[model samples]
Target: MLQLPHQSLQVAAVPAQRTAAREDQDGPWHTEAVCRRDEAGLFFAPSKEPTAARLSREDAAKRVCARCPVMVECREHALLQPEPYGVWGGLTAAERRVVLARRRRREMELKKSASAA
Candidate 1:
């Protein structure tokens, strides 16, 4: 079985202390993540994983994300970090890429409109 770091595993178990620390370091939103209660393997793929298995695992992780209260924050973090692996905020790596592309395009369009005006 894959084991997460001790700190990651303890997030939900020690909410008050962890939330305060995480808020100081990363942000308060992470303290409310539902994924903290699940196994890390559910969100990240194992090395050399098969496509079907990876899809199934990602789907399961997304289901957990779907109900999360901090999903938007998590997704924004992933997009800003351009997270290269795993499923974050109900989206796989490929999905994040598409979103980034769209964001870039929109920004470019906005810039063009501003310059034209």
Candidate 2:
């Protein structure tokens, strides 16, 4: 079905909007995140959390993020700000570091290829 501009469509009880609220579907949609209703502790790791506890905590947090309405925007915001803590977009900070590293490597490879070409 065709939705008019600026209109949001949800398929279920959860607010899984078909697209972002922005005109281009990429605006600051984090404002509508379901996480806002959850406790802040759910999204952050404890300073002295053990490895096993951290893993379990992160997994639980990821589940919440998976169903979040603004998962994409939250992830983007975390990466752009280089958030030093917490679980965002179903990824712990460490996981996001790995993604960023991979992205950097890919960018370098692309640059090298372009220069060589």
Top-TM-score structure, candidate number: 1
TM-score of each: 0.77, 0.73
Per-residue lDDT tens digits for candidate 2, residues 1-117, read: 112234322211222323333433555576667767753455665456567666665666788888888788778767777776787777788889998999999999999999999
At residue 71, candidate 2 shows an lDDT of 83
Model 2 regions lying over 4 Å from their true place: 1-27
**Stretches of model 1 off by over 4 angstroms after superposition:** 1-27
Which residue pairs of candidate 2 clash? none
Candidate 1 residue pairs in backbone clash:
none
Model 2: residue 38 alpha-carbon error in angstroms: 2.0
lDDT score for candidate 1 against the true structure: 0.71
